[model samples]
Target: MSTISGAHIFAKKALLPDGWAENVAITVSDDGHISSMQRDTVPAGNSVGILLPAPANLHSHAFQRAMAGMSERRGQEAHDSFWTWREIMFRFLDVLTPEDIGSIAAFVQMEMLEAGYASIGEFHYLHHQPGGTPYANLAELSDRIIEAAEKTGIGLTLLPVLYQHGGCDRRPLAPGQVRFGNDPDRFAMLFELAAGTMSRLPEDAVLGVAPHSLRAVDEDGLTAAIALAGDRPLHMHLAEQVAEVEEVIAARGTRPVEWLLRNAPVSENWCLIHCTQMLPEETAALAKTGAVAGLCPITESSLGDGIFDGVRYTENDGKFGIGSDSNIRISLSEELRTLEYSQRLRDKCRASIATPEKSTGRVLFEKVALGGAQAIGRKAGALATGGFADLVALDEKAIDLEGREGDEILDAYIFAGDDRMITDVWSAGRHVVREGKHVKGDAIRAAYRKTVAALRMRL
Candidate 1:
């Protein structure tokens, strides 16, 4: 058992139905779950700064971390959309050996820990060989990913992705997509294999299923994947671009979100990523479904995706979470800043996402934490008994946070500060980051640099 006593504890702030606290001690069992939290008392043996439950990154493609800054070169003639960028991504993945993937994933997860992300929902889809040939062991790629998480100490929610086709019409996958393609039967076997591998991870880790996108799977495939998911979390890319919206409507009878609502069983367990181009009616309807809108504002902006209707979504009580999708820029505060800034640009107002009683940062942070925790199917995002003891300690001494307290501290951190202010982080009661650095940062980064050098030679 371990005990951490702090000057202030933001226990249950994100999910206890009431928010924020101070002068609390949190206890955790040897098995990594929170045992209890005592208010207004300092336990003997440990001392710390302000503490708060860390947030889970609801969506990530860990391998993309390797290609972070390499895609910025302008193409020969014209506009570069997400589709065009995907080609570069496919080319990049063609050279990633399983060892390379494990190294890069460990590096990314280490960065996530330092940035105050306790868990990751890895939306893994790079499955087979370069030419679509299956490895002798189907689970080889996924095992590397699980190994990466285990080495890094970040809580894992591995979402093995099913990519069946290139479009909604059940069109054959393009040559570049071979590595990601899987028939429903093959996908089921992979899912079972993934589950077995997940059982070998740290006790808090979990396995989930992802149907790559509406463009990648047909109606029958989607239905089968959902049934296979059972009660586990279901995540998918949906309506991320205007082109995708148009394609879904052209192929199906409706837009992606509308088609999903009509056809799929989307409930609380689902997370629809990048719902960027939704109509007001579609947005309102989605808000009622209890599914999380997995928003990656920095990545969306970097990729030229449109702004989400945050004000309207919040007014409708829609759930949402932030992610560093591409990992091009991995700062949690930057994601929050970009999310709110994008809304402000669209709405032409300051504090567009703030409610009457809450600051913009507080509202954004709390909502995303709740939404992400729910989507990942974890008892985290709050410091409470039975919750995973995944917590972050901010450097109150940081310049931007010098005089802040309560919601103002969140405001300064999100609006002005960056990951540098995140001094320490713990995942499932294990200290993985301290003094603003991940415990394994240097070693992981050195390994990642070697992998990147090899990938660059091939790319």
Candidate 2:
């Protein structure tokens, strides 16, 4: 990605905070925030083309990007599902070194920028090395993540996860789970170290805390982690699978979402990832809590997780955002398209989950962008004064997008086209991607290839 010192951009048309605007001139300050705006103005000599506010990738486990196609083989487990997929993932991570994580994460972030995500909430949990022991720096892997963000120039909301036990019953961690396990005191130190490492990051960076999940954390651990987060965003996995939901119920005497609502303080500052198996009552109640549902439609579909009830969720005004959780495929269009298609498949309907006044595509994109920014705790989601200049420019020359404007353009771009339509991307005023490719695409791809090849040979 291209990193710019400062920029004055003029878009032929742009999606503004309120709605679309024509001949928009955006002034980006040296410190990387949008300082001023001028609409209906003549194009500057250095003006950019058709611009849209890029959405944030609110949830990701970057290491899994390497395992995208690796898990497609049919295994011995009959009726293979999310739990079976986890075994393969565990094996893959067993051999990953810190350097490999940094390279792989950089590649993933680079792909994200080209795919039209200007920011990422990295739900990073691969804390230690292959074994259960911590590295000398303690935050070695966390520092590697920061290095990847600095290398890629994408705005980062790093969520250092705390994984204590293996299950809701506080079972001892299995051998494969050792790397992610940490006691409350060590986790506190790691969290503080992660926060300290952020001082070297760009101004737009955020450091959030993730208490891996209800299965991995006890009441005391969750409480301690929450106190550490203060006002910053907190994230967790919730009811991603039926077995997990049942396990929570068996141990906690309630459904996973219901348990969180009853026992904890969940608000807009918290992002609950993958509410894939929630009941209708849980859906309606969770929506009213002002928390963001971090939906990973592509990954969820790939893993055979149950469909999220978008129809019920939207009717209750629930906030939601998309994530490339498994990173099997990183496509903004596919994620949003799959989200709608899942609802359609479940409801036996066409053009499902849309606002009365807006097309399905426009409504979904706007909702995700707003919710994603909120989830990542970034000053993004819109192109306006004081917002980070995280913008994506589409090539109007693409045939699918030709003669398209307004919501129709968004519809065509998302439904009819892929990332090839994206000509350039900017994150926090830095031009990191251009001509529909990351500026350092080749170098990052080379490093990722070496890492993946080595890991695959070991496996």
Candidate 3:
């Protein structure tokens, strides 16, 4: 099983790079890429219904999955916003050991695969112990993330984050933020160590860099991170909240997005997470830069962050993608649904994301699938020869999906049905999810349960 090579797959109907086709046959070679494709072919090997290219979740904080429902309570502040939620998150993460993080991340990855995501861009930042100390190995926490990816067979773009300060003023990291703090020099060392650790994973695994956010890293640090990242993916938080925007403006003499576009070489390789606070010009300008706007609708709504300008950005031909973010929920359908619904609610109109030629669901799925793959630097998002065989199969027999064909299948899945219709998922030719569950889910869930139980007692 060391090499899951020379596999054949058939689908009743699939969304190919050209368009939808029936009776599709795909061949995966030893290197985990689609080697060939045939249409109107006889069923061979594993057969599936309504197959499509699965998307990479472009931004995830895997450790934050454990704090899903723990920060729902209203704090003493009159308004409990992302700041308040962040405080609770900081407190919660303090108790997580490397082992705990590994287990929790594995569980999160399993859920992502079952939810129909074939890959993930883990915006990992937790790099040290509870206090302000590093482990014997600087990349201990990052290695845990890699191990989790290995266990779950999720295509991972491990982004080792560089967090330099508490805010844009370059103040020292707060007590709760201590564990994530690393100067530019220290971060360089940590990144190298993490890269060495990532070599143990499969060839498809990517090591990227993230400079936490404008509030977390300075100009020199951001430059260092970009240089360190080279041509690989580079993700960062940008204007996710009003207070954050104001803070960046106060310290940097411009808004977060404006500052980055002017100061850094923002391009297709960059993924700016949560541009929910951008002005019209900023949206149009950033769209032209070819950077992906990573949206986390569920977590943004839960945190009371403002809605993103989906219609305007799309009008400008912007690239964007979805992410589970805090991992409060891992439903790929709901993420797409929430994105479209949020646009409709903001504009007080239906089909806000739909174009003249395509349905809402079709536009959402296709755009996000392609944009997500680009953000994660994965050669996927389409059933094409030479691309990664990252695919998802839905239950065509489901009541909601009955009689659906072409784009209508995507429409029904996102609107009427949910991830429950996801029957299988393959990440880089590895059939990790089968018959609606992860292959190693039971053991992963058991470990997560024990870890959470111990964490609760400590809290």
What's each prediction's TM-score? 0.95, 0.98, 0.99
lDDT (CA) per prediction: 0.84, 0.90, 0.92
Best by TM-score: 3
**Lowest lDDT 10-residue stretch of candidate 2:** 1-10
Off by over 4 Å in 3: 1-3
Residue-level lDDT tens digits of model 3 in 1-459: 123779899999999877899999999988889999999999999999889999999999999998888887899999788888889998899898999999999999999999999999999999999888999999999999999998999999999899999988889999999999899999999989988988888788898999999999999999999999999999999999899999999998999989999999999999999999999999999999999999999988888888999999999999999999999999999999999999989889999988787889989999999999999999998889999999999999999998998889999999999999999999999999999999999999999999999999988
Clashes of each: 0, 4, 0
What does candidate 1's lDDT look like per residue over 220-248, in tens digits? 78888898988899999999999889989
N/CA/C clash count, model 2: 4
Q: What is the lDDT of candidate 1?
A: 0.84
- Candidate 2 clashing pairs? 1-432, 1-439, 2-431, 2-432
The TM-score of predicted model 3 comes to 0.99
By lDDT, the best candidate is 3
